[model samples]
Target: MYKLRELERIDLDRINKWRNDQNLIACLGAPYRYINEDVDHEWYEKYLHARNNSVRCAIVDDKQEEVVLGLISLLDINSINRSGVIHIMIGDNENRGKGIGTFAVNEMIKHAFYNLNLRRIELGVLENNLPAIRLYEKTGFVREGVKRESNYKNGKYVSMIIMAILREDYESMPSLRSENDE
Candidate 1:
């Protein structure tokens, strides 16, 4: 089982390391931008101070005693509109393809709807990223549209597909909610 918890200052080093991993970088369809110590420190400080965004939750393996397997966030928040962008990164290669990303994302969506009162949650994934797109679809997100040639990586351009799930859609999905909700 995995649980989402607030990201902390101590996790920066691990996060940065994962961000630079060759496989993960390629999966994201972006060239890795290495951050120096100073830049990483600055980034952490800014994230710590930000109010509108939430760099929430390192998905931890419970049996492993709080080992962070991945990171998830709700960004570009618009409180008045009750919406935000969902971002996720599964850092540990060993932990990938284990359904942890789906679990983490679903938890974040629940928090966004129930706690944050968010009406809509959205994300963008590279068109070629089938696993992520399938995960999002499984979690109630529907493909809204595509942005052509929006991402340039590995000497090629790829389309970015937009996916979104509304609160009403989530509320209607019986299997998605825990038994306590009804």
Candidate 2:
């Protein structure tokens, strides 16, 4: 089984390693710079203590010892309006290109709409990253528009595609429906 939980201090080292990984970070839009353990610790401190609008979680294999797979977050949440922006990073290379992201996203969407009572969950994907864009599309996110040349990476600019899934759309997803339903 897979689960999402609070990112703890013990996972800090591994998260730092992935943050410095050239190939993995490249796909996730991270800067091509290395940070030391001091920075990692400081970053974790901020994450642990930071403010009110988000739910930050680490994806883990619950069948085991909850070994962390990656990170996922709901940012810029507006409680009054029931909306949040989603962000996911599969920091583990061994866990990439599999259906793990889609699975985690499905579960996150359920939690957001059902548990949190959120009406809309949105995300932005780099237009050039086909694998990621496909994952989002398959997970019930509909492309809203493009933020033209919104980010600069490697040597040039890249556009981002805005995509989202509303509570209504979530209810109709295949993964959200099953014969087992009562």
Candidate 3:
């Protein structure tokens, strides 16, 4: 139903627009970011092309116009540690809750563990984003801990919840471990 495609230059515009969406950015633990086309162009030139420590992909829905349903990526991939942090966003609220995020996440995690041979994958979630927290748990991520008063966004301080799924934990979950077999 969905596949991960390398993020090309064309995708920067779409991703930049997605980030500007209030709903999408509101739930992110990262500081609210605003970007214009020039910024995106610069980002593509510096980071996307560098390929130093990350892998980024856009989630494409086969049933649709092959539009990017969202993005799923592995950031800060440390070859020495064999670990990376998962970063994701289900582009639009309308495209969410339809199993799209879960599908993309499972595929990325499978690639991270089996293909990339990474040992650990982790993510941070804003405490108020209950839906995302629940989604992470359902996908096999265990609650690791929390960063108290991590950031002051908008008006108040919000805690960041840290969660992770070890290589062993992901392998044991039969459902999330075999996207390639499909």
Candidate 4:
């Protein structure tokens, strides 16, 4: 089983490794860039200062070692508008394709809709990232629109598909467990 927890100091090395993985970076909408330890530290510091507008969590293996398998976040949170953008990555290759990402995404959705009282959660996925697109669709995120060639990666541009789920969609879907169960 997997669980979500606050990102801790010990997770930095692993996160940095994932950030530098070219194969993984290609799948992300962000541009590929080398991230050194110092840069990672600076990013963490910024994350700490941006707590009011973000909710980042480490996805952990709960039944065994409690090892961090990935990270999930809700960024650019607008309390007045009750909306935010969500992102998730299963950094550990060995832990991928084992339902960890699904668990983390669901948990984050619950946190946004139930805990934070947010009505809409959105994300943008690389047009060619089929696996991620499928996962988001499975989680009730509908394709809102496409940004043509919005991101430049690997010497070429790629489109990004915007997806989002509103509070009504979450309430109508069957859940593995109720929000209050968390």
lDDT of each: 0.85, 0.83, 0.85, 0.90
Clash pairs (backbone) in predicted model 1: none
Question: Which digits, one per residue and each the tens of the lDDT, describe model 3 over residues 40-155?
Answer: 78877776655768888889977753598898888899999999999899887789889988888888888998889999999999999898898899889999999998977777
Candidate 1 local lDDT, residue 11: 76
lDDT of 4 by residue, 66-130 (tens): 58899999999999999999988889678878888888998999999999999999999999999
The TM-scores, one per candidate, come to 0.92, 0.90, 0.91, 0.94
User: Model 1, 122: alpha-carbon shift in Å?
Assistant: 0.5
Q: What lDDT tens digits, residue by residue, belong to model 2 across residues 1-182?
A: 67888778888888888888888766765557888889989987876676477777888888864588888888788999899988888887789887778878877888889888999999988888899989988889999999898877788888889999999997877766762384
Ranking by lDDT: 4, 1, 3, 2
Regions of candidate 4 where Cα sits further than 4 Å from its true position: 64-66, 176-182
Q: Who is ahead in TM-score, 1 or 3?
A: 1
Tell me the spans in candidate 1 whose CA falls farther than 4 Å from its real position.
29-31, 177-182
Candidate 1 residue lDDT tens string, 8-63: 76777888888777778877845678766677678778877885566567888777
Tell me how candidate 4 scores on lDDT: 0.90
Off by over 4 Å in 3: 63-66, 174-182
Models, CA RMSD each: 1.8, 1.8, 2.3, 2.2
